[model samples]
Target: MLEPQDHRLRQREYLLQISRAITAQLDLASLLNLVITYAVEMLAGTSGLIAIYDEEGDDLLRIRASSQLPRDIWPAFAPLLALPLADLPRQGVAVLRDVATDTGLNLRQMIALPLALRQSAVGVIYVFRAALNVDFSANDRQLLQDFANQAAIAVSNARLYQGVLREKQRLDAMIEQSADGALIIDSRWRITTFNKMMEQLTGWTRDEAIGRPCAEVLGIHSDQGVNICLTDCPLQRRPPAENPVAEGRITSRDGREIYI
Candidate 1:
């Protein structure tokens, strides 16, 4: 048996390793799998489950991962997810003793720790041990709580990142299909987004325009060939607007003068 200090040391190392693994994965499904697998491995639990709460008005808890549970008994555990989060302990865990005796499942004991952030619980992590007589010490609770905290942050970040990616995809689709010319620039005035319409208008393909300065690519000039884009750059003169409008004559890729 490891000494108390040694156990803590080992647990800390495990936490660091698992934290890296969790944060390294951005996909929600893959992150959940990593959570369950690391939970079972690090805690020496026989099986594990992670339930993520849906925040978009569903008030629903979805099971993100379940490992080594028999098909027939998984149904029994599913109902626990429907329980009022109000009933569960907020800062600690609720332990189930000898659940195998009650349900004839393979699990001997189980610990349910809420994945909490601030005062609210974002999700729950449950781990099962097959041992018949198990005693979870205060240190054990502390260790599980640590993992739960890190898991909550990783899950929440992944969900947020995924939502942003989906929204970006949706907007990109719209921008690509837009009728008028559309282009986007970074804070440094370098072209970051170039749509097909803008590509045609400027006669510069997206590959050629991205990362190039807007001044160089747009090459906007007055009718008398005086540089217009440099003097009236909207980003510098005006606050960012949703529907920004700029007008000038630009030299096309073919050296033709086009007025916008």
Candidate 2:
């Protein structure tokens, strides 16, 4: 009974809900739940699911909360659902009008949208209604399609954030395990970070070393007794491509010799 323009406005409002959901939470599971809940409510779907494919695309994991189907049914559909349907005749987004008439098994009045990133199909978003009284309209399909696109972006961002966090943890562990004193410097020759060994060797804590200029802190001297911090400082000058390692002798505050 809704007019075309009214449906369009509803869809816009639904998209705004999805956008706010993605931005509100950094946690992947919570964000995904919000998306699925919003999709089901806005599209008048009795049941819905959000599945993410494994890296090999051979397995699908149902991650979001669903309404129509019991949680027990998902594991059985994992294998078939995970396979990429990109080559199907309908492609990118596929819609089934009738649950009873549709040939696909275990799905009824379903809308499947491929989740793509960097031109590669990563997974699919599925929304459906199981009741015989419920029917999907063109407007519903369009709204679900837009919601799927937003879901794809949210999933990609969450994955990237998790990846960065994992890398940071790995780097921190490696730095902690290193035997030699190691320090990281930016292009400006300022100390960005260093390992615990560096702190112990120089009698300086990490808080004191961070953001300080390397030349002023390390006090490097040449063989000729010239202060390397004043001129020809390896830390201050850019390194040659062929010989990138910069080696110099530094005198610590207590007159200890340190090699950088």
Question: Please, what is the TM-score per model?
Answer: 0.78, 0.67
lDDT scores of the candidates, listed in order:
0.74, 0.68
In candidate 1, position 179 carries an lDDT of 97
Tens-place lDDT per residue, model 1, 1-260, is 66768777877787777677775775666666666776676566888788888878586777776767654565566556766646545412332332354466566566678898877888888887877677555656667788788778887787777889899888888999999888878889898888998888888999999999999999778777777678776666656776656777997888777889
Name the regions of candidate 1 deviating beyond 4 angstroms: 22-25, 67-76, 84-105, 229-247
For candidate 2, write residues 13-85 as lDDT tens digits. 7678768877775576666666677787777676677887675555655545554656666664454364456
